[model samples]
Target chain A: MTDHLVEGVLAGDRRAIARTISLIEDNGAEAQATLAALHPHTGRAHIVGVTGPPGSGKSSLVNALALYFRRGATGERGEGGSPKTVGIIAVDPTSPFSGGAILGDRIRMRDLAGDPGIFIRSMASRGSLGGLAWATADAVKVLDAAGFELIFIETVGAGQAEVDIARTAHTTVVVEVPGLGDDVQAIKAGILEIADIFAVNKADHEGADHAVMALRMMLDLDLGGTATVLHHGRLMEVVRTVTGGEEPPSQGPLPPARPSAWRPPIFKTIATRHEGVVDLATAILAHRAYLEQSGQLVQRERERAAAELETIIQQESLRRVLACAQGEKLAALIDRIVRREIDPYTASQHLLGG
Target chain B: MTDKKIRVLIAKPGLDGHDRGAKVIARALRDAGMEVVYTGIRQTPEMIVEAALQEDVDVVGLSILSGAHMALFPRIMDLMRQHGLDDVLVVAGGIIPDEDVPALQAMGVKGVFGPGTSTDTIVRFIREHLS
Candidate 1:
């Protein structure tokens, strides 16, 4: 059964792909076996993560991009390029109070349906805080193994928790709508570091220039430093006099964690109108090219592998420990820890028979 | 193995733009711990069936305020059959009248909810059928 399922998924069978994802969602032993079989055939597709806040046109942008990928930009053979098989995994939040979700990301993406070249699946962030379901990465792997040339993972876009997309996609595009809040908010968004490209969506709205400019300045500071920023105001003259224009001083005390040659570019877009979508898609492909050229592809893959390995090891170790600490024994042990008779670390060690 | 959460696709089909009842039922179903994929207002039957296939939903809740239930329900069911979605349980809600209930039920709508129907009743109907 597993072999047949694997064969079907590899052949890009629609029902098989859908069923494989359902199995992953179920997270059963059979599901694990299926994924294990499909694992060797993975890693061919370019994964891109699209994230932003609610009402930021994240779905529309993804829809337009998928359409562009499926039908091509010019609806023809060249320049905008040929159509590629695309897969999309769009996620919406599961209500914390209800533990169920209204996954409506497909509403805006209605245009892409019935297209044999595209497969879209909507996911609910089933208790996962990072705007992604626990099974999303595996689902992407399923699509990748199914021979999708490009797969887009659309995050739940739940603001701060949206960082995990960076862990899943080679390129993360953060969509921001102008005048969402204060202009300075762009500098505060943690997605700034995760973003390989930023689309200032709703660029037709008020303060689009300010939004774009603010994002530009933030990137300048993030990519280069205050020197790049200092080349602007009165700080330029002061810096020139301070260092004699030799090498501008550092922006902050802490340097960037991982220095990259790629600077995230910001594009003004009105996603609903399909404006700037072609440019955004081009930039995404360019980022993929850069990742391959600059060795960041292998680096990112290693980081992802290390993370997945740690996650599995942690789960397995805990499972093994729990096997020794049966129900009442675990409850009593927890009570003891609560009373300060023993600490949690010591209890864990005791369970491990260490 | 733990039981899978029931996945339901709540869609508003046809020319009806009024989706308040659909949303109410969707929220109620979610409250019962079912993952509901809502294809918002003004969805075509084809789109609904396509969504059902992609989402692999256990149930489909169609909400149509327009009196096109008789006109559209058969086509939706026919499409579902054509797409091999015959196993999916489908229910409907909206201004469906008492006189139309039996006909709609005969067409495999399973459940017909009218105005003033409690969301609990709808949720319970789905639970009972699926269980």
Candidate 2:
């Protein structure tokens, strides 16, 4: 039954695709069988992960991207009917206690719901440390096997753990907005390193220029190089405010910071208005082109596959080991650790060995 | 309080970051003796469905402050149908207008809880529907 569904999905039947995804999400025997049968058909799609700060308009951007993929000025492939289908995996964080997703990504991208060329799925992190749902990789695989042209995985921006997207997605987009304070510095160390494209959304707001400059400066410093030219536009505007004159002393307190080697272009956007989305998409495509040219696309996919395989093994092994331990034995082990009869390391070794 | 757990998945679909209502409802559901799964902000329909499946939840609730509810709810319903999860009750609460209620209900959403609705009302709705 599951194999039939998989075949139907591969044949571009929306009902079949929807059913297969549902089965996979349910993790039922049928869903597992469906995935196992469909695994061979996966890996044709390009996976792109979009993440950023909480209010960085990631959803709007994703919505706009989906729209473009569905109906672009270029008369490209329509969502489902086109030669390449698109799949979206929107990842939201789940509440530890209630296990529900607070926000819905599908609602934002509602316009594209009926597009035959596109398939979108929302996933919750389920209180996972990495801010990505455990099922995200598998869902992407299902979409790939089902013959999606592009798979977009959107996640909430966690400072450090966001690097996990690098391991899953072929291209990573880190979004930022204005008025986040000096938090950009914090994001720099964690997310900036992993981003192939840097988008500054809500550019209509004040301090957008400063935010862009700050990000550019951070990128330059990380790469250990200097920006060829100081960003005179926004920086000078700030200088005008500080000095209260067109030309202030060169040694002003707001002196421009030195630049770095990798200067990721800071594109401004009013994502809600769909402004600058085309450029953003262009940048994303360009980045993918770079990856392909550099042969990093294959390498990234290989690494992601290996990592996913390892994660599955670890998770299944842990589940089995924990399930095998009875309540009394588990309690006795904890007691031994408390009494120092054996260290936690030794106890785990013994339990695993047994 | 017989403690019959109402396992609910409170999901936010799309890019809207407003979660005050989702959080409040999650708390209310928890207080109502329901094991709530709150997928914190910016979930897609796929993610919500996956959570619903993994949690083996009885009710799948969504909070969409964004106006994209029209597009989002139906897709979820379709996914639910495809997965043969039509038995799992679908409900929504957020900035939904009165006009959208019928359409949402037609899409298999058993109930629509909008603003000004009390937590007790939501709880009772779930209890009533699930029962």
Candidate 3:
């Protein structure tokens, strides 16, 4: 049955793909069977992850990137020797109370829907800590097996936990824009470290240059190099030289330069205009090549596989523990915990052991 | 026996900060006994697709008040096609002008709902399509 699903997917049957993804998302017996059958046909596609702070035009950037990939097929080095097929996975946060996802990503990427070669799916994190829905990896696998040359996973910018995309994707792009308040500090830690490329979207804004300069400085820091900082003392000295008066070179010492481990390239773009998309795509492809050449691809994929296994185990274990405690016993335990009679850990242990 | 519920994913894509309509539709859908996934704001086409796949949803409803519908809807359709989700109905709401409706539908969007559309109307449309 899984093989039949794979054959249908490869033949571009939308219903088959949908059903297969449904199976994977549910982690049902059917999905596992399907994946096992399709596993052999996987590993040929390039997976890219796009993530950034909210309001950075990530969707627009993705739209443009899809267009760029489609355009790439018209040139040399193209597979299928025709319009390339692309898969997109848009991950959105779910409402805690509703167990529902507000899968609103279609608004920004409507332009590509008409194309026959592109497939897009929206996923909800369903309160998953990593900003990646549990179903994402399997969905990507399904698309990969279906023979999409490029698969994009777009994640909501939920800061720390969202960095999981780095492990799942072959290449990760971090996106930002001007006026995001302390642009550098806003993304300095966690997910920022995982980005292979940084995009400065909304370049049409006034402070884009400053944002770019700050990003470059941060990149320099990441690369273990000192970035030149124009100190107030130096500025005062220059002012005094021009004025020939007594300001005595302002008091504060120069800002210290911090070195870094890797410097991701920053590209400016007005995502709505589709400007700079070509360059961004080129940089992404180039980065993919770099990863492959540097042997990072193999390492990354291994790490991703390990993490996925861990996640699956954790999820399965949690499911078992929860299922074991359901009904009257579960309700009673919850009542006890809430009433401070027993802690959650003890209750969990009791439930699991029983 | 209860009627089969319609599962809907209501998402806000790109930089649009407005979500009043998205939230309203989510509630309306839920009230109608359709499980709705409200993906807040700032979603990409990829995120929306992933949600639909995970939730095993029957409809993907996009709320775009930012006038980005033209550039966004097509990417979603393309993804649906690639993932073989053409049967999953795609709909759009929120501030959509009349002129773009035809184009949106042409791109495989099942329907477009603008402001002033009641929850009952939207829910009925989804049910009718699903049925």
Top-scoring candidate (DockQ): 1
Interface RMSD, all models, one decimal each?
A: 1.4, 8.7, 6.7
lDDT for each residue of candidate 3 in B23-96, tens digit (9 for 90 to 100): 88887776565557566688788777765664567888898988988998889899878876778988888888
All candidates in order of DockQ, best leading: 1, 3, 2
The root-mean-square deviation over C-alpha atoms between each candidate and the true structure, in angstroms, is 6.1, 9.9, 10.9
> What iRMS does model 2 reach?
8.7
Off by more than 4 A, model 1: A74-79, A225-260, B1-3
lDDT (Cα, tens digit) per residue for candidate 1, span A1-354: 778889999998877888889888987778989999999999999999999888899999999998888877665533445678899999998888878888888889988877878889989888888778988999999999999999999998757546888888989999988887675776674666577788999998998988878776665455444433221111221111111111223354434333334556778888888999988998898888877876868877887888888887998788877877778899999999999999999888788874
What C-alpha root-mean-square deviation, in Å, does candidate 1 show against the real structure? 6.1
Q: Worst 10-residue stretch by lDDT in candidate 3 chain A?
A: A236-245
Q: Which has the better DockQ: candidate 2, or candidate 3?
A: 3
True contacts kept of each: 0.68, 0.04, 0.15
Model 3 interface RMSD, in angstroms? 6.7
Q: Cα lDDT of model 1 overall?
A: 0.82
Give TM-score, chain B, model 1.
Answer: 0.96
Candidate 3 regions exceeding 4 Å error are A1-3, A72-83, A183-187, A225-262, A327-342, B1-5, B8-27, B30-118, B121-131
Evaluate model 3: give its TM-score.
0.69
Task: Give the TM-score ranking, best first.
Answer: 1, 2, 3
Candidate 2 deviant stretches above 4 angstroms: A73-84, A183-188, A225-263, B1-131
Cα lDDT computed for each candidate against the true fold: 0.82, 0.70, 0.73
Better of 1 and 2 by DockQ: 1
- Please give the lDDT score for candidate 3: 0.73
Residues forming the 10-long window of minimal summed lDDT in candidate 1 chain A: A237-246
The best candidate by lDDT is 1
